[model samples]
Target: MRTTALLFSLSISFGSLAQLQPIAADVYRWKDLKIEKEQTRERRQVLEGSARDLDLLEIHTSALEPGKSPHPPHTHDDVEELVIVKEGNLRVTIKGQSKILGPGSVALAIPGEEHGFENGGNTRVTYYIIKYRSKLPMNIDRGKQAGGSFMIDRSELTVKTTDKGSRINYFERPTSMAQRFEMHVTTLNAGMNSHPPHTHRAEEIVLLISGSGKIQIGEQHKDASVGDLIFLGSEVLHAFTNTGQEPCSYFAFQWN
Candidate 1:
C-alpha cells in the first residue's frame, strides 16, 4: 500500500510538469505585436512554446535606444541563443570577444557561453533573439568542441545571384541544442516564387526583412511584411513568394 501511494504521488507530481504544446505553423505579423516599453528599449514578444525537437523555444524582438543595452553579459547553462540584426548597428560580445555588426548580421551563442548586446549606432537598433532548449541532453563539452560561439557579418558573405533571385549563404553547424543548424538569406524577385511547395525534417522560421510576400503552409496562406515572421513545423508543406512590386528578402533558418 505504501509503494502504491508513493507511485501515485510521483505520477501526480510528474503530471503537473506537463510538456509544453508544440508551436503550430503560422505567421506572426509585426504590426500585430504589442510593444512593451522599457527603460532602455521596446520589446515585442513573438513566440514562446516547444518545437518538434526542442523542449523550449522562444523568440522575441527588441529595439534598443542608442548606447543602450538590454542586460549584462550572461550565461545560459542549457539554452542556446541566436541573434539577428535587423536595423542599425549592434555591438555584440561573446565570450569576451566583441564586434560591431550592421543590419543583416547574425550572432550565435551556444550553451554555457557569456554573451551580450548593445546599440552601437546613433540610431535605435532592432534585433531578434531566438532561444531554444533541445529535447536531447545538453552537452556543453561537445558544444565547445565545435565552434563555441561566433558572429557573422553580412558584408562578409558573398551573394550569389540566381535567375529568380539572390541567395546569401550563412552558417551550417552543430550546436548544443541542435544536431544541425542552418541559416541563409533569400531575396526573391518581384512576383517570383521562392520554390515549389516542399517539406523537410527540420523545423524552420522565415523572418521577412524587406518588401512584402506570402507564405503558404499546407492549405493556409499568410501575407507577410517587413518584420513579420513565418514558422513552419517539421515536414510541413510550405512555400514563399514575393507578392509585392519589389524584391523581398527574408532570413530562413532551420534546425533539428
Candidate 2:
C-alpha cells in the first residue's frame, strides 16, 4: 500500500538474507493495488519490496499532468532508477542534459546524480519507475557516456524471432549500479509459450504489456492480463503461456 518513494531511505537491507529466497509469494495484480494521488500526479506501487542480494527493489507507475513532474530533480545516495515512458512525451533530465522520451523509451538515473522527469507532451504522461539498490558496493552509472545517465528508445531495437513469436532485447550492457539486469520485449502467439515451466538462478519479472494469458508458478497457475506482473524467484519453477485468442506480449526483465 506504500512505495519506497524515489527518495526513501535504505537503512533496511535484504542483501544479507539467506540465499535462494522464493518470490512466488510476491505476485502483484495491478487491479488490486492501492493508488496514491496528488493534485499533479498519481501512482501505484505494484512490487515495492526486496530480493536477496538486493537491498531494495521497487517498481511503480505514475501519471503526471502536462508540464508537471512527480518530484524535483534530486540525487540519492544508494538507489539507482530507471524510467520507462509508457505513454506521452516524458522529458528526462539528468544534471543539465535532457531528452524528450516517447512511449516505450527508457532512461536511467544513476546514484549520486540529480535526475527527474517532466511531462513535455500536451497530455498526461505515464511512466514506470524501477528503483533498486544492491547490498554490495556499486557505482554511479556513466553507461557508455561519462555523465552517469543513459536513455534508449525501445523502438530502435531489432526484433529477434523466437519459435513461439518474437523478442527484442533492450540494453545488454551493464549500468553503473547493475551488471546483469537484462530487459526485453517478448510476444507469444496464441496458445504458445516461450519455454516449458522451469527454474534458474536469476530472479525474473514479467510485466504484461498487452493481451491476456496464463502463468504457472510451481504447481500454481493463474490468469493474467495487462498491467499484471508475474514474478519468478531464483530457482522457482515458472512459465508463461498465451491463452488468449490474440498474441500476448510482455516486457520481461531479469536480475541475477
**Model 1 whole-model lDDT (C-alpha atoms):** 0.91
Model 1 agreement with the true structure over 54-157: per-residue lDDT tens digits = 87889999999999999888998879999999999999999899999999999999877799999999999999999898888977766777788899999999
Candidate 1 segments exceeding 4 Å error: 1-19
lDDT of 2: 0.78
The whole-model lDDT of each prediction reads 0.91, 0.78
The residue pairs found clashing in candidate 2 are: none
Q: Taking the tens digit of each residue's C-alpha lDDT, what string does model 2 give over 139-254?
A: 55433354456778776778898888989887665666566668888999999987888888878888887899888887888888987877777778888889999989888887
| lDDT at position 175, candidate 2 | 61
Candidate number achieving the greatest lDDT relative to the actual structure: 1
CA shift at 4, candidate 1, in angstroms? 24
For every model shown, what is its TM-score relative to the native structure? 0.92, 0.85
